[model samples]
Target: MLEQRGILVPEAVRGRITRRMDPHVMRDWFRRAFAAAAAGQVFGDE
Candidate 1:
């Protein structure tokens, strides 16, 4: 979703997301990504 919007997903952010263990949190991040302008926005303070 971020890619479709031309938002860049940095490696650090990718690593963080990839490192997540909770499926619920990951699912929330996926939903948030649909509306995020940047990859960081998907995780926020996480």
Candidate 2:
């Protein structure tokens, strides 16, 4: 879903997930972080 949504996942979360997950397992935590940042920016702009 992340790739489909054009999201950029972070390397930190990616590394931690890789330690406990299969190399192909993908979580969208970084996308959530990015969304948080974008939301903050939008509020700041207002």
Q: What 10-residue stretch in candidate 2 is worst by lDDT?
A: 37-46
Tens-digit per-residue lDDT, 1-46, candidate 2: 3434555446654455456544322233434544553323212221
User: In order, what lDDT does every prediction score?
Assistant: 0.82, 0.41
* Candidate 1 wrong stretches, greater than 4 Å: none
Clashing pairs in 1: none
Candidate 2 stretches with Cα past 4 Å from truth are 22-46
Among all windows of 10 consecutive residues in model 1, the one with the lowest summed lDDT is: 37-46
Candidate maximizing lDDT? 1
lDDT of 1 by residue, 1-46 (tens): 6777899988887788778899999889888988887787887856
Q: What is the model-wide C-alpha lDDT for candidate 1?
A: 0.82
TM-score of 1: 0.77
State which candidate has the highest TM-score. 1
Error at 19, model 1, angstroms: 1.0
